[model samples]
Target: MVVDEQFRLHPESTAYLDAVRGMGRSVNTERNYAYGLALYLTWCDERAFSWSDPGFENLLRLRNWLVSTPLPVRGRRVQPVIRYRKDG
Candidate 1:
């Protein structure tokens, strides 16, 4: 498991990732999940929300934030910024 100094994942989150790896998940998939969960944790921390116990209303707020916020795309070339859009 890679240790990131900037963001420390909760023990349960680490164990979950390890389990996913033990299940033969691809490295790309594991990495993607780790990155995504890390981002969510960071967001929760910033908003003083408990990651393990964010209430339904808090989850809705998170959804709203995610939908409105622009996310950066990573690549070798110029990365585009995108936001999550909810489809009705």
Candidate 2:
């Protein structure tokens, strides 16, 4: 339930954030979501995406960014260092 100083809620983000929180996420999890989403939006800044636009390449780039992020654990950097995997 963290809100920015301007108090504007991003409509597209609420449902996903709530779903993750409902799964018993902690404060750190919330922070991660916020950080990741902020970066994602920044990446999308000059690009408007839609089915009628320049295909789905931007969507894949966002997915790639998520896949490359590593989660910290007990002072160790673990392998398979990604949030999600693409099915082959």
**Candidate whose lDDT is highest:** 1
lDDT (tens digit, per residue) of candidate 1 on 34-88:
9878878878888887889999999888888877876666566565656465622
Candidate 2 Cα misplacement greater than 4 A, ranges: 1-7, 50-55, 60-88
What tens-digit string does per-residue lDDT give for candidate 2 at 1-88?
A: 3235687776666677888888999979977897777666555654654322434777777677656754433445654444444433
Tell me each candidate's TM-score.
0.76, 0.47
Model 1 segments more than 4 A misplaced? 1-9, 76-88
